[model samples]
Target: MYACIAQWIPPLERPRFIAVVLYAIGLGTAVALPMCGMVIDAAGWPAAFYVTGICSLLWCVLWFSIIYSTPAQHPRISREELQYIENAVRSSGTSHNGPTRVPWKSMATSLPFWAITVTEMCNSYGITIIRAQLPTFMKNIFGLSIKMVIT
Candidate 1:
C-alpha cells in the first residue's frame, strides 16, 4: 500500500516515503516483542492469542473501509490521478488475469537445472550433517540444563 502511493511521488520523495515505511515496519516489530512478552508473563499464552485475533479483525475492518479494488472506485482518487493510473496499468502489461503453465519437466532435463540441483544437493547435505549431530554436540559441549535440552 505504502509502496504504491510512494510511486506517485517524485523520485527523490519516493525514497523518503519508502524509508518511512521500512522504519515503521521495524518499529512495529520492536514495540511488539516486549509487549508480547509482558502480556505472556502477565496473563498467560492464551491472552496473546486473543490479542492477536482482535488485532487481525480490526485490520480487516480498516482494510475494507480504506481500500478499494482500483483507483477508479477510491473516493479520494482525483480524475487526473485515475487517468494516470489507468494508462500506466495499461502500458505496463501487468494488469492481466490469466493462467500460465511452467514446463517443469523440460526444465528438469536442462543443463542449468541440473547444475542448480547439484549445488542445492551439496548445500542440503551440509545442512543434514549439522542437523543430525547438533543436539548431541550441544548436549556434550555446552552441558546445558535438562529443561533447556528438552525445549
Candidate 2:
C-alpha cells in the first residue's frame, strides 16, 4: 500500500500521505486492541470477534471504493497528469508488462525468502502474544481491574 501510494502521489505530497497512512494504521490498531478487550470483558469473546468482523468488512468496502488500480483509471485523475505518469514510468523503466507465471517451489527454495518469512512469522507471533495475553497478564500479575486491563 505504501508502495502503491508512492508510485502516484507527488514526491512532496508523498511523505504527508505516508504519514497519514501510518497514523491511520497505528491509530486503528491502538483503538481496536483495547476496544476488543473491553468488548470481551463486557460481552464475551464471541461478541468481540463479531464486532471486529463487522468493522473489517466495512473497511474492505471502503478500501475498494476509495482506491484505484492505476492513476490513469482513477476517476479524479486529469489527462495531463495521467500522461505525465505514463511518460515518467516509461522513462524510468518502471512500466508494467503483462503478468508472468512463477513457480511457488522456486520461491519456497529461496534462502533469503525463507529467512524473511521466518522473521516475519516470529514478529507476528510476538505481536499476537502481546495483544492476546497482556490483559490477562496484568489482571493476574498485578491485580488490575478489567477496565485497567483493557485500557
Best by TM-score: 2
Q: On residues 32-142, what C-alpha lDDT tens digit does candidate 1 reach at each position?
A: 545555666668768867876787799899989987766666899889988877666656554444446879899978999999999999987986676556546765899
Which whole-number lDDT from 0 to 100 does residue 48 have in model 1? 68
Q: Each prediction's Cα lDDT score?
A: 0.67, 0.79
TM-score of 1: 0.48
Judging by lDDT against the true structure, name the best candidate. 2
Report RMSD for candidate 2.
3.6
Please give, for residues 5-34, the per-residue lDDT of candidate 2 as tens digits: 645765556678888987897688789878
Per-prediction tally of clashes: 0, 0
Task: State how far residue 48 of model 2 sits from its true place (Å).
Answer: 1.8
Positional deviation of 24 in candidate 1, in angstroms?
Answer: 5.5
RMSD of 1: 8.6
Model 2's TM-score against the true structure: 0.70
Which residue pairs overlap in candidate 1's backbone? none
In model 2, which runs have C-alpha deviations exceeding 4 angstroms? 2-24, 41-44, 84-91, 103-109
